[model samples]
Target: MTEDHLDIKTPEYVAIQFQIAGLGSRAAAFIIDQALLMIINILAIVILFFVMDGMETSPFFLTESTFPIAVVVIGLFVLNWGYFFFFEFFSGGRTLGKRMVGIRVIQENGHSITLLSSFIRNLVRLIDSLPTAYFLGIIMIFFHPKHKRLGDLVAGTIVVHERKAKKKKKLTPIEKEINLRGLTENDLELDDWTLKSFTAKDWKLVSTYASRFHQLPVEERNQLTKQIADLLLTKKGIEVAGKTDTDLENTLLVLYLVLKDEWEFEL
Candidate 1:
């Protein structure tokens, strides 16, 4: 099952690898969530019906003034949309179903889920729900390398098992193949904040990029390298002059592996 894991380095430089949740587990969680929401909505509608009946005989104007309609619409919205948003945000990425299933949503970088990211992902649920019963979503999850649905892809989030991550003591072959021995302290401009700024998720991306660099077309490779380098440079506030995009990208990834322990103070 080591093959199914995604590696994420902890603040201590320990490799903490998480198992990506598969379609079965994810579907179970989704079904649980839907059932709970359906129950809640049923109760809400029952209450609303009684309230509307009471108002129909009175002149309070609630039943006839579009207020009841508005309430029903908002209730549906909350049940269908806000439920995921609120739970994921407050629970640090787990809704009740996800928590029950022992899985959680996390930034692809392994960071805790944020409100905005949660909102974006939940918003894309509309697209994922297209053509009934999430057929498109199931197809996407089945075919996508990472098992991400449309919402996950749009929000740059992934669902992972909540189990303790498997740690690796030694570097993988890909890590060894791309070395930073030539890059000196001056080149990395090592700082505590620099190391802290990069997360396990970011490390995963770096590893993927480096490992697949040669396989990608030149244009795509260059574009990805530049994007990765720019994000790191902007976040860490460091600059490496006199290097091409490929060189800069490789240097950043290598520096991360080499100097990961140096950032403990900042963390």
Candidate 2:
């Protein structure tokens, strides 16, 4: 199956990759959640049935009271409307269906979603569901590159596939031998705007260079390294002089890891 990836630099300055959840997967999750809600409604109905039946035989039976009807309405409202909000807010963005589907809602910036953001997104669900069966949402998701629905767009969130835990790949002998000095914060000549302009894709490119530099053939790696350094550092008005290609590459990677979280940035 084809999957879209979102690369994000985290607070720790490490670049991470997340798989974007597609419309098909989202629809499956929604259906599963709806079925569970339906079961809840059915159980509620059964409970009401027993209560009413007991009331009929009671000496203090009162058919005149509207309390039972009001209770049912409130319960239904909570089930249909509050379910998602409650689950998302409390469960770190996973509802039962989302958990089953291995997807979750998160901010596009690689940070946990705020409570108000969650509330706003869930509130927009009414609009997304308009004209029946999330028709508007489906249309939006179809066109959006990240497959964001109306609520997600409004809330600045995206649904992503949950990352599976895996063992880290062992470093090759050459990879282990690569000794690149880390760039200190003093070395950074970047302004806020330049830093902000560097997107998740840029971070991914930097990270890939750092991780695979030692494994590449020397000539090829040097050429690739020089090209990347020129684009990010020299083009941005950052001074790069007297630094070897290897040094430039390692310095940039170190700078990326060190200052990535210092600036407030978004994708």
Candidate 3:
């Protein structure tokens, strides 16, 4: 089956739309954070003035005031930016915006976002925000296929939709058998997308159509199956063995095992 027939409920389109919405939400959060920092800075200045007013006779007031004002400015900057970078980089794979918008940053391999990755991603935010107004980042997102901003492209990160609910089901006995069958040349006869890059939706589609394989003419089915087997062998970097159907089945099983192992370890 083609990708279109997989009944994908979470295509890249949906993911990209979610990301665009998330940007707006995140921008709002940044504004709120800045406003809060400004309020704090104002309070600090007012407190500093009162303390100095109370210390009537001190020439040291000027010296002390300079240091405190400098400290307050530096502290505000750190507090304003540091809290977000620390939490987003080292804690959960989200900031307040991401959490609110139901998206998460993850590694390219689909693992949880790591501390180093987070730091690399956020540290480059300044670059992403370059040319004084984040114009570069906006242009990149507008043009790039994945809508990646500068930080995302640099850090090998992407944001995806959080699955809303758990899928509850056990593999059927036959399904379990199929999964365990291992890779064989016959499996290569399946669609390239199915054998090489089956997503969750692809697996569902395969399960739906597998029982109908006999509907095709015998010769046609054989040709398609052989094509799949050849592709599978190529993917495995294995020499093709001219063999019987059973041998082809076994080879397909081996390919399946390899792909399964890679997928599990990646996640």
Candidate 4:
């Protein structure tokens, strides 16, 4: 199946994209969370009946103490419902399950899930779980283009894969090749006047490209390098016509080196 992507244009005019988490991944996360909640519920039951009610582990133990029964009822409500709300809101859209599954909840605009939105979604989860084992929710997810359930529809939230940007730990072969190119800041031949044209935003663009460079597939890397070269290299009065893919990437790396010292701290 074709993957679904959600794009957000920030107020700063920056664009971000996220991949919608699949049903299998969502189910895994849900199962993990449910398992945890089940364990907690069991523990809570034990404490309410055995510890507080004088070691009476009877199945119908709640009748012994009205106070303990009320507490248990309230605790059940909190554990069953409030767990998702507090965790999704306070934990940056990720519960323990979602974190482990590398998925997270976010608003439609790609912002962090808000408190109200989280509450709304979890509140509607009761309906989603109705008619036996979330049957309605599973059907809704199976049919929905973005795999949204009723709760997600009401809450304006989406489950997306968490993007963890991993910087290169060591100099890979491609990076080594770029480093060996011996193109320093001086190679660009930029003076104060020429340097003044470049901005911190430009540095960010270059640095982002540099960091993600080796991680992309060859075709994407070449295409992206060419695009960046066309967009940015011309400002430095550089020509791109005769350069190989490797040469163009090296030029970008050199540009990143030149801009790093000036704009690194500003951001």
lDDT-best of 1 and 2: 2
In model 1, pairs of residues that clash are: 109-201
Model 2 agreement with the true structure over 1-267: per-residue lDDT tens digits: 467999999888899999999998899989999999999999888888888777877767685445676798798987788889888878888899999999988999977777987999999999999899899999998889999988998899999999999989985443344333534556666677887777677777776776676678989988887888887778667667788775776667655664456432643
Error in Å for residue 131 of model 1: 1.7
Q: Candidate 2, which segments miss by more than 4 Å at Cα?
A: 57-59, 168-267
Model 3 scores a TM of: 0.47
Please give the lDDT score at residue 178 for candidate 3: 63
TM-score to true structure, per model: 0.58, 0.60, 0.47, 0.63
lDDT of 1 at 81: 90
Higher-lDDT candidate among 1 and 3?
1
Q: How does each model score on lDDT?
A: 0.78, 0.80, 0.59, 0.86
| lDDT (Cα) of model 1 | 0.78
RMSD of each: 20.4, 13.9, 15.2, 13.0
Q: Residue 130 in model 1: shift from native, Å?
A: 0.5
Q: Sort by TM-score, best first.
A: 4, 2, 1, 3
Q: Write the per-residue lDDT of candidate 3 for residues 62-159, one digit (tens) a residue.
A: 55656766777788777756665676666566665567666667766556777777778877877877886677777775566555678788888765
lDDT of 4 by residue, 48-153 (tens): 7666657355556456557786878898988789889999999999999999999999999998999989989998899999898998888888889988999999
Extract clashing residue pairs from model 4. Answer: none
**Per-residue lDDT of model 1, residues 1-267, tens digit only:** 233677888777888678898888899999999999899889888888887778877887753856886889787987789899999989988988999999999998788988889999999988998999999899988788888999999999999999765697786555555543444435555566666677766766665775786688988977887787777665676665566976776676666554545442444
Residue 22 in model 4: lDDT? 77
